[model samples]
Target: MKMRSLIATALVAALPGVACAQEVTLSFAHWLPPTHPLQPTGFEPWIESIKEASGGRIAIDIYPAQQLGAAADHYDMARDGIADIAWINPGYQPGRFPLHAIGELPLMMSDAKSGSRAFDAWYRTYAPEEMSDVYYCMTHSHDPGTFHSKEPVRTPADIAGKNVRPAHATMARWVSLMGGASVQVPAPEAREAIAKGAADMITFPWGSIFIFGIDKEVKHHLDTPLYVSSQAIVMNKDMVEGLPDDLRKVIDDHCTPEWTEKVVSGWVDAEAAGRQRMIDEGHTLYKPTAEDLAAWRESAAPLTEEWMASVNKRGIDAQAAYDAYVASLREAGALMGEN
Candidate 1:
């Protein structure tokens, strides 16, 4: 069946001046809810753009809320052709792609737009090597997140002995480093973890707390841009390679750094609104003092050391790569708090 589809695509490419509308359709899978901002704001628009660019030769159908596969399996789904394109969270599979993990570091990104631009550009340089299994499209950022706990977490000491549902692998290590138990779970299951007493707090972006229904489970919120998770859209290599030339070009056009910003823009606004909603609802949103931030910064420094060591073992100049990443974020004015 796959061979016949490839042969038909090849025939279309070989024909002399023959054109067809809506001749190619790709399956795009993601784990976010259908109502998530990324749907209407990001993927839908981008899909339309691709169809328009190809003169209606390309169409992309999105399968949301893990309808195609689990969130952690999206990367492999794209690589193995389970989905032609899949949205993935690199940090979900820890230590697998060390270079990409740098994006998960604490206090790295500020706003989603500039961060998306910076991260997409920077990761392209390494993606050919680090994420070689699939066609690396583009990367986007969530607005940075902080601690939303059942109790106040003003200082690093406050995290002691608590169970936390971390945003990603980096945050899990951060929780462990602060003497908390990292209650490992995906975003969808977060509220259940807290309600069932498996976790007492969570590190998540502002608006997602409500979206995931975790807002009812925890009260005290640390109003800080602690960290942002890195996510990407990738395409199956075979599917892309087998597409007609015009359709392939359309796909390439949508995979740029500029597109990353467009995809993340709606999500950015939603997160900002989520933050304000928490305040309006009378949640105890604590903006950390300069002293408290200093302590948090001091505590997080070791995670970098550990990250550098892990990258170095892979034969890359870890410090240079880390510096380059920071430089990219700085150039984009997206280094957390700049905006």
Candidate 2:
């Protein structure tokens, strides 16, 4: 019978190579809080090392707290694919990522694995025109950032008229250049905007104000590493161009810079063990005084001269990318506080 129609046309040409060898989850979205430690110690052990280097054919379905949307819409939900991977922050959209605010300047690099390997090697030298669309997969920072107040701010005249909350937009223009009043929420609504007082001080990081419970509604903690929050993890560029080149080289061998210093030094050692469990749950932590941290670093020196005139009006080379990100954090000794 024509050899049974040539073995049913070779099983219909091997059914699209057995449906392209099946298995491929992805999804990922983020906005923290899956009992955050950037989710059980940084994206569940980097999604189990990209499902054991893709032999399991890649799988990952995260979608933490924001469950796939708001936290400033996770970099446009991974540039509109609505999440094939996200976790972005890029200072939660301020001026749409102004050169990732040089790892949110101020007192840069103290931890978060050498400021996430010097802001993922200086934002991969401007990620194809500052992160072209998507697929950028690394860049991290967050271990510094202070004043989780309810009072006791130390200096900069105790952050003048309060109502703070900053976290992005250069700490909301360094809390409107040290005179507070910048309230823009979103760190999971900053513990209900500082427990319904509608914010009186937030600017977190370093145990993320008790991983977003805002340390049971603030009581003051300025341990002073003030400023660091320039995250990224993007993916969806047509889902990494519809992967498969060996699961896109196991997502480019776990999108590295040595896995951005092993997933930001395990979320900066879980923000130094959540700031020593908010100083053993007592929480009035303070610690400033080097002349009140030099008057809060001279009131944050005009936020690094207005972030080098907004990265030299976008032409960039903002002081050679801030002196090669402080000489790659003093060649990775991880030069903490007092720049």
Candidate 3:
């Protein structure tokens, strides 16, 4: 024990920064537990990449598995400077991120990369103003949401009366429009809800199917594309403002609007991993027929108009934001794997 301690002390002494230098350690908190393989292989690599890119002068302390608080409380935590940084799901607190929720509208994303690009593009084109409080780093989604249900959802009518968890308010509305009872719950909490008969199914990025152990509770996964909800990594304004210009530039370089799409591609990868898990666990995966998709689209259309009206009541130019999002989606379509 003494020899081991001596070696540790010697190593710390050998590294000037490791010894007595009070390295400015920035804390980054997220809701996922460290055991989620996606973090070490995916999100954690981004951390390592930034550190290597910065030559270790800046160190980030990552707190995952909701070490700080519940998922829904993360945004309030970040806004209040509970931590230097965090990845927050805007949908977790519905009213606070009213405008940013536009990304969650139906069928806006096709794949993670394009969805991310489209999300980044959408944020730039329509909702940059919504993120003024924090240093907004990126906007992206899980690959694309799909239905993990107690029963197969191969047809539109299957949604009727089922307790489905939707990604956003609009999604919940969409479910309700199609006759499902949309429940709003954090994905982390969805597993227990399903196992305990609290929720019948959920529409989320495929990853939650595995991350939250939904495969064991739900036997079927709908193969049709659902809209992607935007999630972001943000830094407290005070911490961001205090950074040296060079260090700030480093963050800027890494967290670029374009780089954001690249960095967040993990979400899609995580979703894919979840889908594969579903297959491995013997869950039935089904795709809706063309006629069924048409039925879904027709049923869900009114929710879009309803969203516009709600956003309009919030005093921003709803038409402009809506139009911009639609236009950006059209432009983002090719990138999103749409013809």
Candidate 4:
């Protein structure tokens, strides 16, 4: 029996394909807290799918809350191989990815689920050029974000001279356009900025106000799906290219629009629930009137123009790209018509 076992082991080891079937382990790094909804609701299930799909040959270790790198540095971390995969807020490093800024445009989409599907599908075309440093896996957005402030912001003019912490670069630009000053800070540091009065307001998704403890400092909420900030899950380019075919197939299968929608659904539901939580807590929710909405949209119009000019300067067909993005949103029924 012992001789038979030895012969079997020897036979397995001698086969070239069997010898190369060693398990692959990867590091996934993100800046959200371990308890954040994205951790359990989005990333874990996706990770599990990959593990099962690969027959336990691939293992991913998650390093959350900036354990591996800073929030803004995540893209670079993945590119440099500091992390095998990273969750990146592309707008964190403004102007670096001009083509991707289309997703951050104000009032472009109404919800995260369908919007995520549209954004992920549309981005695949541009990712190879805009985010070429890394292997683009999937892209998603939070539920649309609105203003939360110590003081009420009823109109675009209300932002004038105020200090606001924006969700992304496009929001920062919008704040500036409205004559407000932007207190640029990453998500983990947002609560501190608001508490210290460095920022008197924040543009954030409804659910994260409580998740990041920003609700304690802000009492007024704007009832609008003003904008959605885009996020990407990317992998190291060289590592992806060097992977064995079977292992690479596992990764590829998980990086599709289907997987993106599945992962973002939980977060979308959680964030949508925050509106009721705020209401129950007696926080003031300000709904915009038709005129107010029109004014806000007018103020945001230049943002698209700015994006177009900026990307055109980068030698891209900006108009064509914008049209495609809008087409994707319309197809998904996520686009909010001009109001």
Candidate 5:
């Protein structure tokens, strides 16, 4: 996957008036119910940006919640040209997107804003070529995921023998490190799985529980972020390459740093709202101290070695990429410090 650098300045300026055979229509598919936090929080704003940028030259129709197929299918949908655009989770298709897996490593990100920044930095420095197949709009990770359980989970011993829904493979690894069995349950299934006794714990973004109505069955939440889950937005390769300059500019404009920050801000807002809603309903939030977190991280170190190996087998330089990602974050932090 190889992508040309940003288009020339002159061509970019004249893109809007570039004539087309007829009006173009783009269908973007996602796996959230209409009111899901991510959809309203970020997706809608992105679409509006696209529409406004297109200046009526192109039209977009948003299909939410597998109105077409699951999140796993989104990558393929865009690859096989099923839809013009799709919100995809590389974690959903394990063994295939090992580079993106770095974003899922246990406790890697402190917040969505940091994780999202890390994601962009990871792509720009390590995996941009790998993602060139699609016209990537942006990539972002969850702020942080806490433990939602029927019983309090404060330490490794507490998670022993529990069946937990690990949203991403990295979280699945966290479950293993904590001595818990892993259960495959998407957000929508969290409620049912908890209710049926199929799962005893879950790692998820707080705001999503309300969006998916899972808090009703979840009684307690851990304070520590076990990890963050991440996904990328991509347009069909051909569709993007063929876009007239104006429309391409619109795409670029909608996915900038400013927009990414807004997206993260929205998620944080939703998480705050969800936390309040759960507290209103008597859900208890507990924090495990640094000592407890150290214990958990010790058990989780083996996972990073195994994961790096998994990515290496694919000819991807996992450790180097991870190192570069950390370096980029430090660089970003320093720049922020200067500001």
Candidate 6:
């Protein structure tokens, strides 16, 4: 009896070390504050899902608010293993990701859920070459974005001479095309820029302005779906490739078109809530008339032509990609306000 007891104690003592040896922990990095909807409503729940799906074999450590690095550096941080995974805004790097600019195009899709699913599907076809250095998890966008400014901007003419904060390269070009000076400010710093008179306007998803506390500084809001910001979550190639089969499958399961939609759908509700909040606050909200929408569309026409021309130079069939995206949006019933 004494000999049996000693053996059982020794086996129990070794169990924790054995479990630690078999478990894997991945680091996830992003720039959003902890209280942002994307964190608590989207990513945190998704992380829990991954942990449950992996049966405790995989664990994830989340670093929010650029704890690992700057927002623009997130892609390379994951690529270089600064974090095993990162939420990256490809548009932040400008021309480096022209293909991704499809999601950033003016008046593209209506809501984040359908748009993100389409983006994930479309980007998968190009991920092999465009995001070759990293393991592409998924691509998503915020709900349609619009101008939040100090003064009412009802037409293209109002944009001229306004110093606007652009969320990405395409928007930057759009600002320049409309004769506005582009003020480069990441979302977190946009409030200060506007407060200091460095930027008179900014383009963002409806809810993000409120989440970032920029709503307090801006008195005018464009009640139009002007554009959306393209974003992705990627993993280090080496880390993905090195994972055991079961663990890799867990990651793969979480990185699907369905998951992309799930992650971004919450933001759609948040956008509506934010817009309503602004209206309740008595901020000047301009709802464009049909003629106003027509003029704005006409003004943005040249940007599409320029984008196609640039992508063609890189040997991409840009028109086909754009056409496919439009088709997907139509099929999903996510055209202008259809959602």
Could you list the CA RMSD of all candidates, in the order they appear? 2.4, 16.0, 5.3, 4.5, 6.0, 5.4
- Which residue pairs in candidate 4 have backbone atoms (N, alpha carbon, C) closer than 3 angstroms, thus clashing? none
* TM-score of each predicted structure versus truth: 0.94, 0.34, 0.86, 0.94, 0.87, 0.93
Winner on lDDT between 3 and 4 is 4
* Residue-by-residue lDDT tens digits, candidate 6, 1-339: 123434654576588665332466778999988788887778888999998998976778899999999989999999999999899999889878777787888887786788789778878888878889999999988888899999888998999999999999889998898899999977888889999999999998888888888888888988988898989999999988977788789899999999999987886788768888888888889999989999988888887888788778789998997788787777777666556
Q: How would you encode candidate 2's per-residue C-alpha lDDT over 120-182 as one tens digit per residue?
A: 876787886877988888878877777778777777787888888788888788778777788
Across 1-339, the per-residue lDDT of candidate 3 in tens digits comes to 123434654666688666432124577888887876547765677777767766674677788988988888776677678877788888777666767777777765676666566666667643456767778777766677877888878766888879987877777878887788977777777888888898898887777677777777888888766677777788777777766676676677766556766666665676777777777777798877777777777886786776677778878788888777666656766233365
Better of 1 and 2 by TM-score: 1
lDDT of 5: 0.74
RMSD of 3: 5.3
Model with the higher lDDT, candidate 2 or 3: 2
Clashes of each: 0, 1, 1, 0, 2, 0
Colliding residue pairs in candidate 1:
none
Q: What is the C-alpha lDDT of each candidate?
A: 0.88, 0.77, 0.72, 0.91, 0.74, 0.85
Encode model 4's per-residue lDDT on 130-177: one tens digit a residue: 888899999999999999999988999999999999999999999999
lDDT for predicted candidate 3 compared with the true structure: 0.72
lDDT of 3 at 263: 67
Which one is best on lDDT? 4
Superposed model 1: Cα runs more than 4 Å off: 1-22, 337-339
Q: Over the full model, what C-alpha lDDT does candidate 4 score relative to the true structure?
A: 0.91
